[model samples]
Target: MRKRGVKSVLDVATGTGFHSVRLLEAGFDAVSADGSADMLAMAFENGMKNGDHILRVVQADWRWLNRDVHGEYDAIVCLGNSFTHLFSERDRRKALAEFYAMLKHDGILILDQRNYDAILDRGYSSKHTYYYCGEDVAVEPEYMDEGLCRMRYRFPDKSVYHLNMFPLRKDYTRRLMSDVGFQRIETYGDFQHTYREEQPDFFVHVAEKEYRMEDQEEGSYGGAVSTARSYYNSPDADAFYSSVWGGEDIHVGVYAHPAEPIADASRRTVERMASGLGLTEGSRVLDLGSGFGGSARYLAETFGCFVQALNLSEVENERHRQLNAKRGLTGRIEVVDGSFESVPFPDSSVDVVWSQDAFLHSGNRLRVLEEIRRVLRPGGRLVFTDPMAADGTDLSALQPILDRIHLDDMGSPGFYTRELIRLGFVPTEHEDSPGGFEDLRAQLVTHYGRVLEETERQEAEGLGAKVSSDYLTQMKKGLTHWVDGGEGRRLTWGIFRFTLSEG
Candidate 1:
């Protein structure tokens, strides 16, 4: 609490004023609140006895907390596993909404729950260490199902008490907190940073109301952003990509010639995607997964459009900002360090959304598309390209390629078209494609082959020494898999254009 700058706290589940009195002694303005009047009364008495402190107490139901308890708090502490008592989803949501309403704009909610995941998955087992450490007491589950965890607590006196809880799973609780508008949530196991999922006796969640861009979670969509960020920010990756892909554009290209320079062919791809967008001066463009701001700079410079370059790599974003500044496009191109899965822009705010060979990195391509749909204005254009699996190809055959990218599946042309139509995006006409702007598929074997040869040449010339031998070997293997996949008709790559439905 002190680290988070919390001075005023609302102990919402102050069982016996244990936390409220402690907070007061620790130089905090503490208010004790509980749904039970008896609990609040006991808490008040305990507060006075513990520290001669008068804990301002409120007897209020959690679902209607603000109806009785007024004033916002810098922090709300709902400990003691009290939240699991709410058996209904409606009650849980209402209570969480009340907690959110009672918190300041930058306030935080620290809540804890028993590790019902472990108890339900594997039978109940605990060292009796952290939360219930009393040597004379024993706690075990009396009954457990998907919904209920009835615990039997036997004290030193041989007296037994039972607790009926809703058995909230870790991920489910996290999702509820997120659904209730908590922007960032960090869960700790047994109050420790390093603990296995099934090992923890309790999970403490610190949910922040404020949204910090730098502290965004890897998200439930498959941890792709985190993986990509780590990979691209590495020294070898930066050095190798900068050397081979011309530092500006790292995506696959539209090869005009078999031996075309990687940078030129990549620029042609950007041009092809942008040609049908009808971009005008000052048009707003969002470049998702914008690597090194290559597409962003091109779109901004050529069409005089303002581009928001959203990417996960700080290393790449820094380089992108530097390039934007160098080319006097800083005002036109804004580099944002973020994931495309959760774009930090308002709904219907952009005229165009652009990406290239990037959506393949998303664990949840559907979520990425939904975010794109959210940010794009009515009638806005979405033009981009990605490396995809060929329709009807057995995904098992692509395991080598999948292992290289750490993905289970790749989006296909069929998947994109179906999803785009479902998301209210109408396919626009493109002159180069035969299938009415739907089928612009191209095999990337030539592009990858060219890159591999150039990289080898660069290595022979000692210009690529910064790239480790192991990395080069892995790159060779990965590129070979891609080439084989492309040649075998198991992979496809191409540009897709869609317009948000005006209706």
Candidate 2:
């Protein structure tokens, strides 16, 4: 194997520091981060023997990788069941997401998956008793609230022993990385890395994915696709978003746009309302009218949750589809097309129905609400934010305001709640946005500054210059209406969180 001008490497889930020592010995700058303190300490000691400034190791979870630790690696390695340790489908994808987020554009994610044929319901000595330094190391079944799993540990000379064995079918892990935007994702074996399934000890694999500008596209989500026209007719939409958010990777727009950052705010609000809504790890969520795919990503990543991100625009779905692919979150983040009225999801498919500020575009509010109820698992949550009438009044007044503001928007708080209850969905929570769009209007504009000057230069071009004005104008008036309106300023924004009945 050629060294190939590679300089640094990040060893994820690095146990015992063996990889770090080997890299340091080979004169590479190795930075290792792991969740196990005991394992990391061993890595530290092992590195120490090779002189003072050897390796940098930190204790961290692979699911939410540290920004400082990722990026620019010749190799970003996760071996054993490190990739499979994510507790759930959501966690698995989140781990892949963070891993992709941190790795340098051209880096490799080398990890192994449990070859079911080599382990589960296979293996000659069904109960092979093994000895590691004279301590017993066994792999067996154990069930927790989470799921079924296997654990193996060696005692006495124990350093980083207990193997937290997570068995993921080979195809499962393979599809996961592929969907997560790994361009050249492939499987290999120990040392030789042959794809053969004859090995019983363990499987060795490596995934090398190239990062390039051509991978960027408009309205692409979690790496999924849609029709061509739905994408914004950007002379350079991808470039513009990339300049602000700072990545050529899949979700450059996620951390790029200001409204998207609301994902964090949404997370905060939902977490507070979580107790009332009764959502546990098993909950299935629906992100109605999913935008650039940030919230769906957040719900899946932060809550160890699953979300069906339904949207109308091909562009929006495309953006989210790709983002999911990049983050390895496709399993937990499903991007469905068609508006709320036409959702094809089977009845009782969801436990929590959530929408951010994107619900205003739908036409039939009652049928939409009814569709939500039909799809919700009993007692499932129906939570979202909408422009509410400042004072309980005619739906007429709200229509004009929403018209100037744009989209098929209009629904007073009274009308919305009544519709929810009418549909048999328990209206769990609702409130007028305290600040309305007034605060966000300013915040959104401020967020448009160029992180990369090329973005500024490009936006300055002739046709592109006027593109953002309309969106900004609509936002400004919308905010002014709610902010400066008299005592009962009729329109306001709000957030909601709720649950589905276990029955």
Candidate 3:
């Protein structure tokens, strides 16, 4: 909750006041509310008993909660399998709507449900671990169906209590949250991210009300863009890439020799792409997905062009700004924290758009192309290199790589050529023929292989404390997949240069 910036919370299902009291103890401003006055009374007493704590209690029905409870909160927690108590779909929807209305714009709703699917599909069983941990007491589902799950609880004193609950399936619950305008819903099994479907006794869902790019349709690549932003912003990623690929260049290198330094080879690829741009002093260039502003600095120094280094990672952008200041190129380079999918610049604002091995990270390659076209002046150059899947290659064969990158597909050479032309871009002088960079399919096995070797060497010499062994292992596996894919002609990497149509 602290990590997510939650400072105030509403415990909508305070139950015996356990959660609400805990929230107050944890230094969060919390309000406890329950539909039943008895529950609220007991919760207030429990709060007092816990630590002389005073809990602000409210008697409110979920459907019209705001009528009694006022003020929005950063988060609202409906826990202890309380949501299933609403038998009708209309009631559930109404309650969720009320919760949505009672939250700040960036607020979150944390709801939990019993794993009724397991009770219905497989028989009811409990490890007595997560919930209902009382010894000499047994709780089981006496009767269960798609609509109803009747639970029976027996105490040590031979007393029994029964409750009927709506059997909410995991996917159905997620769908309900989505339908209620929750932009993002993340579910955890017994508070664990990695758990079998039927293993968890409860499923906790954290739904965010704020709009995010990843909430877009699957093909939009919003999820992939979000993943890339998070990955690059991570400390380990920043450290590893900065150390291995050199502090400046983090993209794939076009090696003249297998033994060439990674930074030099990478700069060579950047130089090759820039050669066709015809950039001049004061020319405005936008470097999309610029990682550390290495290429931006080079363009500023070599061609005297002003560059906007647009990237999604704040960590990388901070480093980029620091480097620009160090090299006295801060005046020439402006680091903008943004995604290429939605360029934060005005239309036709740039003389050239430059990217290297970055477009593959986009889920919606076509949208990126459109954005490039929108931002480039007529006859402005677009130079980029992406690690692409070979044309007509089966995507199923690249599942491992795709899973690692959180993308559905990679753009092929054919796809780019068609998209560029469709988006009013004409091949530049750098094109080998009208088909553009067809023969520019450079192999990446050597690049990834060299990276892996250098990474391992750096780790062995104790130069990479931030890079964990698990990260290294995953990196090695991912790099091997790329290497094998390259060797089998499943992947292609190279530079492409084009000019926005003047007409």
Candidate 4:
């Protein structure tokens, strides 16, 4: 989403500062505020520099958004729809009231909403795309329809970022603004300015706070999510995993917890990515969507290169820091907190933009490739993989259910290739590894057996709390989906190796 380049920007609910940092990169006098201390720390570190262009990150909630601001700004943006996280109508209004109070009366307020209709149609899983920084990403946006959209982001390090968004209908939001004292409301299908009826790629609200507040409640407005004493470290640690693929286990790739013994399955996938990437000594690279930063670390230590890994998760950053430091290669790997839609580095910054299976989390795929092209020097190589639909299977019936858990911006493989070519990269190589999803079926046999064995051990020690109910549910759904045809056979992994042709 693009902004009108306002001089001053207060990024409300700046989770991990991904959007906030981008504002700085886009040349705004930006300051980010969020309720989460952990999130603020991540953004503060990323935006810590002086001058008017310098970023100042604050710890504040959406409801108290105006209180934290001593004066008004030219613009205020509540992206990631950080508003939808509200669980009820009252909270939504409360947040909106704060948003209104923070604006300079005529200043613009832009926020986004997940297109519910789109989610009910696509199911979670995008045709994966390769990106910078030895990482690849894909999405399975989850829709609870409880007015919430759960976005699942899988990274190259096998780590995950679950974005829990509460989506409100455009009509409902329009009225909410009217009632909450915001006039001049304009709706777009995202920042692209597509109409709402078109259900454009995304739903965005561009509204102005009314100068007259006589009829409105005189109170605070934009306080977002609060990071209390205890934070939910795992987005779905207890999730049952029963999504649109419902009651079926669909394994697109193999991932073993870093704590777990390296499965033979995990090893094979890693080898494929590493080998296909064609890494050589003294390689200099940028890694995007670098979940746990393992792939970036691998490139630095194994290939003797300097690698920069970027991710949005504070928890994952902590883990990656440990991994990089333990191997005595912390100096070789620089982990930044930001998003690939807008990488923080300058033009032509590296020799290789290595991303593997981590770009899927992006809301826009074309912009991702364009950004990659903007950062790479002439002739720099881009290597990555994405698990995607082999064909546009007529998944209309099951599509809605599946997509609710995944968003539409998650483009297909064909969609990805077309965009890459459209973005001006020379066509290099396109290949798919089939049946990898099939081989994953055994995970039920293996992962289940391990769980059962653990249960027995616990029981022997006089304990009965066995497998988590959600874990069992997810595995069952995954198993059922894998052996089925609707979404399974269509599932496949693609490896892309492209070159940035000399200008």
Best by TM-score: 3
| Highest lDDT against the true fold, candidate | 3
TM-score of each: 0.58, 0.41, 0.65, 0.45
The TM-score obtained by model 4 is 0.45
TM-score for candidate 1, please give it. 0.58
Better of 3 and 4 by TM-score: 3
Residue-level lDDT of model 4, residues 218-312, one tens digit each, is 12110110110001112221112112111112112244642232234433444555564556666678887665665676577677878888665
lDDT of every predicted structure (CA atoms): 0.83, 0.55, 0.83, 0.57
Instruction: Report the Cα lDDT for candidate 2.
Output: 0.55
- Prediction-by-prediction clash tally: 0, 43, 1, 56
Candidate 3 C-alpha lDDT tens digits along 376-472: 9998988888888899999999999998787889998889999899888888764444556734444477788788788878878864334444456
RMSD after Cα superposition, model 1: 13.8
Better of 1 and 3 by lDDT: 3
lDDT of 1 by residue, 142-215 (tens): 99998898999899888999989999977678779979988666667788643422367888988888654433
Pairs of residues at least 3 apart in sequence or in different chains that clash in candidate 1: none
Question: Higher-lDDT candidate among 3 and 4?
Answer: 3
Tens digit of per-residue lDDT, candidate 2, span 1-503: 13445677788877887777777777777788889889988878877865654567788886667654645666777864567666578888878877777666667777865444344433323223221233354444443212434554445555444545456755457567766777544444334333222343434445556643332432232212211122221212332333333332211111234434423434443444343455556879887777567767767777778888887654446767998899999998888876676567899888888775545544456666777878988866776665455446554555645555343446555566556655554534434332111112322222222222333444455323322333333434544444433224545544544444354
- Stretches of candidate 1 exceeding 4 Å from the true structure: 1-216, 219-222, 434-443
